[model samples]
Target: MATGRSTVFEDRSHAGAALGMKLSTLLPAGEYTVLGLLRGGVPIAHEVAKTLGATLGAVAVRKLGVPSNPELAFGAIAQYGPDSARHINEAIYRRALQYFGKDELESLERGTGADLLALADTFKAYCPELAGRDLLLCDDGMATGATMKAALDLVQGLAPASIRLAVPVASPETAAGLAPQVNGICQLLTPDNFTAVGAFYEDFGQVGQDQVLEMLRATQ
Candidate 1:
């Protein structure tokens, strides 16, 4: 990957601890809950929950990848409670529709969405009851904020007392767009010439399923 800024973290654990310390000061005193978006978010949120002295959980959120390029996120899909919700980047989705046409777009949604849901189910465990608690949604970092926004949309259905989004770093534009959607925002770094989330960290390796499962087990 392309390295942009100076190395910010040695690894995920170190980044989490740094983020946790900042988040600790942001959280208010109350019955609070911390939820990490799988799979990278889990490790980061683990340290944040540990610092905040709160209960922890994980939510499975999959980016709705573009048909032409899977890495390009046009939106996201996630499950909250008993229902599944989809959030779309309207501009991108419309552009994709124009490119793929009606039949092709519908087919894309059917095929890619099912695959995304199956991938989500593999990582998701039993998320705790979130009603009446102050909730903090954690992520390692954010680029377009599409996936995080989808996760937030679903969690809102659970009716938490308050909801906050926290991350170690984020693109400035993405953070600004997401700010009003939640109760509060906590970002350690918002780079100017932001290329990608991994660019800010030294060890931005892919977070594995085993690591996610271990963190969820600890919460239980």
Candidate 2:
């Protein structure tokens, strides 16, 4: 884990290129499927797949945010094909229970699960088989890492040969927490005084579904 302040990315493209260079050296030679968590991750995965000559695909995962504060995630959901995974932050969930009933929480999960499946269906045509191939999961960055955890859980069930995670920047704590779950991890920057993922990029603009689809179509 690289500590202290590192260089900020000019944008997602620049970040992707830098991360792709790092991954080329770290990842072993194999048949790889680069699965980028949409929609911010697609651009980063584009550069990575090009660098490694790997098949590119997209994954859809949604955070199960608190009822009052949607930005505060209590859990997340991700789906691929017939498999789906959900991750709950027990501590946060417990705290949430104080303000809301169990039924309300379950409702939130159900809604997120539906949205995850629907979004995954949108990209199903682009995703390749993962059963025998090495998988490289890409994302713009992770703060709490709820969504990435959910993604990892879903991917693990598909029996991939190996799985690794790559990201441009991440909170050190979140990166450390996720390290044990993967074969390997390639993170460009893990800052101690961590802030939101967007703080490290100059143009952390909104990524629409159209842009994501275009990137996936180009890969195919």
Q: Identify the leading candidate in terms of TM-score.
A: 2
On the 0 to 100 scale, the lDDT of residue 114 in model 1 is 78
Q: State each model's CA lDDT, in order.
A: 0.81, 0.88
Q: Which residue segments of model 2 deviate by more than 4 Å?
A: 1-7
How many Å off is the CA of 66 in candidate 2? Answer: 1.4
The worst-scoring run of ten residues by lDDT in candidate 2 lies at 1-10
Over 1-220, each residue of candidate 2 has an lDDT whose tens digit, in order, gives 5655544999888999999999989877776899999789889999899899999998888999999998788989887766788889999999999899899999888887777778988888877888978999999999999889999998999999999999999888998898998988899998888878888888999888998899888989
Q: List TM-score per model, in order.
A: 0.91, 0.94
Clashing residue pairs in candidate 1 are none
Task: For model 2, name the residue pairs that clash.
Answer: none
| Candidate 1 per-residue C-alpha lDDT over 1-220 given as tens digits, one digit per residue, 9 for 90 to 100 | 2234756877777888998898777666776788888778889888888887778888877787777887678788877446577889999888887887878767777876677667666755557889898999999888998889889989898889989998988888888998888889888888787877777778989998888787777767
Model 1 residue runs over 4 Å out of place are 1-6, 119-124
